[model samples]
Target: MLRSDAAGNALGAGRLKRMIRYTSLAVALVVAGCATKDDVDDLALDETPAEVMFNEALALRAAGDVEDAANKFSELDRVYPYSEFARKSLINIAYLNFKMGNHSEAIAAAERFTTLYPGNEDSAYALFIIGESYFRQIPDVGRDQAVTGKALQAMREVIQRYPDSEYTKQARQRVRATEDQLAGKEMEVGRYYLTRRNYLASINRFKVVVTNYQTTRHVEEALYRLTESYYALGVVNEAQTAAAVLGHNFPQSEWYQDAYSLLQKGGLEPQESKGSWLSRAFGNMKLL
Candidate 1:
């Protein structure tokens, strides 16, 4: 987006006329919205006080001119960098950009606010906006999860840095969602390897869900997959351990049933190994 107004600099006759027309429209809009004469003057002229500019931007937003409002806030920030209005304008820019679905711009603006005013009360909100921007851009489990990782990290930062802030609860929720997506991605890859009879590779992937993402919803399926992979590799002890873990943690889960049935097919049952990583991961839960 253009940083400076075209009319702010020297203009040719044609450009001047266009500016006049646009200015007239802006003035008409403010006037129609029951704005005072001063408000109309602020919209029609280049000489806006910081407070007036901030109010004008708010009026534009209220009038549903979101893009223009964001631009107006940007201009206010640029013109009054050290003023209190600048800080307010910067946060508004981030919020409006996010509302407009300009996620990247929202992230940039929010990051800028947080960096400039780390101690400000609005800094937590700015950080939340950055995390929300990344969360909104998260792709499906099939895609690279770099954005998901960033979202998770950003949300965690909000919780860690501003635990008492209003945004912390939602940030914590987003953290769980992002972690679930990452675990789902691993599960997808693990499933692919399993279908190709790549037992060891599949085991490695499912192990991630069990180890690093045990809190996620995918953990039950991850445990089942681990059982499947280890059984395919003729590692019966580990297979039993995995199935036992699944049954112990998710007794009613369909995945546990499947794991149990699979073991039964081989005249085996869900039994925990005396010493196994799966046992250690689940605090060595009792055998099923």
Candidate 2:
């Protein structure tokens, strides 16, 4: 996580995160196959010459000579198909392809690794990284989330198949972040409908987020929107209920504060009968 090599000039936290993520991937490729030769007596490669060439190509990648490094790796794989170095080299192929923005090629290379070495724990890492390659390229929400959907599916596969893997832990974190991003996109669409006085349509969209993505960071915001939407539709009981839930879950949240004011203005009078409809809806609270 150190920012610089020598002068200790620390980049921002975001830059540090990206550096760790990308470098750990590079390290995983090299480390994964270090002992691969132990399992094979004579891997079909021409050994001495192949090691020299592979080292040179690895160094090229380290120097950031990406295109040339890829060509070298390809040539090495061709000359020595089943060697330990070649197996490890495939991971680099995927990484370099992703770095060069060939997302499909990156995914294909990663798929080859997982297919050939499904039992290898490192394969899970490849799967998660493949998901990340596409996740980073997701289009604006208005355009499409096809790639985002695909990435989520792939990461979910990693988490399901390798529950204990560090990659699975990271994938879970990424999944939560991506889900929140998608939820925010949904909220944006809903807000558009609300702005146009299409309260019912907006309510439906926000409700979907609340029901399906309740774990996301957008849940509180969506609940507040629901409060407004219900009030707009003259559903004062539902509005008060939504506001009370928001308040209970997030006492200090500004969204809850706004929603509370909306509830009172809509005549749900938080101090109505202790067992009023909204009170029953919120459950176990003394609003008197």
Candidate 3:
């Protein structure tokens, strides 16, 4: 019986040791679980896929999340340089900047594209878009014309360098429109001077239209104004000369008819003069 008791005690000791080991293992597993949770939290900060992150940022912009979208786009551009995705992302950057009213950044991206891909078929188009970026900022004819000049220069580059390109055709039309706008600005300034009876300055502006901007629709109005300004300044012969030029250059123009009537009141009428480009074949012409 004593031997049986000793064996029972040893077996109990072994079982107690096994139970202690099991309890220790359970505690260790709980501690590991807490550690794993901490690791998962860290992973949440860095687990974003590149494309997935990019798209998420774009989606935020489409949902009116501008600032966040810009951050993501910039990050993508930095990380994925020279990729097809990156090239596409840059264009989106331009569009996003323009949408956010950042004209300077939009123009920079457009110009950079043209420089980086000069042989690209879309280079001219990129340039044309840069011109449009400036064109959109032009205010009324009475305001500062800095943006108008910028648009004109950019469009001129597009036309002079890409004459055969379809972009040239479109750009030429814009050029004409912009020229007309600038001419209108000149007329506005001229009209202001005329309203104040500053005939000399008014005539100078009108002369610019005749000399530098003859192709504009404002030419007819300018010529008529010149005739009137000359008459107001008591320059009768100059008034007649201007009226004659107007009648010769624009026979079908209503301004010509008006100038003729004004000349009649001044004891004169616009008479035919040998001053036309065709009539200049006569001896008095400047041609050799």
Question: Would you estimate the TM-scores of all the predictions?
Answer: 0.79, 0.67, 0.65
User: In angstroms, what RMSD does candidate 3 have relative to the true structure?
Assistant: 17.3
lDDT of each: 0.90, 0.77, 0.75
Which portions of model 3 miss their true places by more than 4 Å? 1-73, 80-89, 99-101, 271-288
Tell how far residue 117 is off in model 1, in angstroms.
1.1
TM-score ranking of the models: 1, 2, 3
As for candidate 2, its clashing pairs are none
Residue-level lDDT tens digits of model 2 in 99-124: 89888888998999898878876798
**lDDT tens digits, residues 243-268, model 1?**
99888888999999999999999999
Between which residue pairs do clashes occur in model 1? none
2 or 3: which has the higher lDDT?
2
lDDT of 3 by residue, 111-152 (tens): 877777777776777788789889889899989888998999
Please tell me which predicted candidate would have the highest lDDT against the true structure. Answer: 1
Candidate 1 lDDT at 287 equals 65
Could you tell which candidate, 1 or 2, scores higher by lDDT? 1
